[model samples]
Target: MAAAQGIYTWDSRSSSYSEIYARVRSWWELLPDGSNPLFVLVREFEATGVTAGSFAVLAEQFSRRSGTAQAVRCDLELAKVQEYPAPWDGLHVCTVTVQVVDESNNSRNAYAAPVTVMINCPPAVTAPTGRCAMVGFYATAERIVY
Candidate 1:
């Protein structure tokens, strides 16, 4: 079926209208192809000491934690960090793009789905630590693939 469609009118009293409407919606909601294999990783850290200069360090730490042997890792790398207007109170939100070898890192394993991993880094109290503490993180490859 074609992916795009014209607007349709609906009649609440007719059952056929509901069926046709649902069919049309399904076409618009088709999943994406596997050409683009990147997904977004959102990490929330304490805002007390996080700064623009610390993004690189935080990204590296995240990459290391995510590519462990237990977790499926297929040349996963940090693509980039998203830009936002400002940080929330007591919380800093960082969105980054992570790239894997395949949709579910299947190139390196037989798993059919992406593994979810949550990793926390030590807090950066002084200037020497050079790392930001990660309070929470969330990422799922299936959603991005869809």
Candidate 2:
């Protein structure tokens, strides 16, 4: 199913759309693979009033908080499509549905921000796993080699 599969527009009001977790600079990875953890970032919006939910069950282990606005942390499990342990050789990627709530009434204009995560790939899973991105949307997924 496409990322934003179940989201619906009531045909009556504001706006909504979908987003990819990796697109968020704070959550992106240079490489795509199963060895590293992936974070799914979703943003929901409605008039200063409307709110709805019944999100796909695929998002396991999530934390929800609401105040001036609402935000959620999606749990994503990376698949091992690329090779591991080889610097510049293995690339890991994960995809998720963002379900952006649109009270502004624009849907087709929806777009994705694919986060390019740069990793220090090793030749193997190594005793020490690469540092995973922390929670929250990042300004940029810049690579910092130590």
Error of 1 at 114 (Å): 12
Tens digits of per-residue lDDT, candidate 2, 52-82, equal 3432221222322112212222212332223
* Poorest lDDT segment (10 consecutive residues) of candidate 2: 137-146
Clashes within 3 Å, all models in order? 0, 24
Error of 1 at 99 (Å): 0.8
The TM-score that candidate 1 achieves is: 0.21
Q: How close to the true structure is residue 40 of candidate 2, measured as C-alpha lDDT?
A: 29
lDDT of candidate 1 over 1-146, digit per residue (tens): 01110111122223243353344333321113422122221111111112235434433333111111222321123222122321222223333333222111122312122332222223422212443333323333332211
Segments of candidate 2 deviating more than 4 angstroms: 1-91, 105-130, 134-146
lDDT for 41 in candidate 1 is 19
For each candidate, give its TM-score against the true structure: 0.21, 0.21
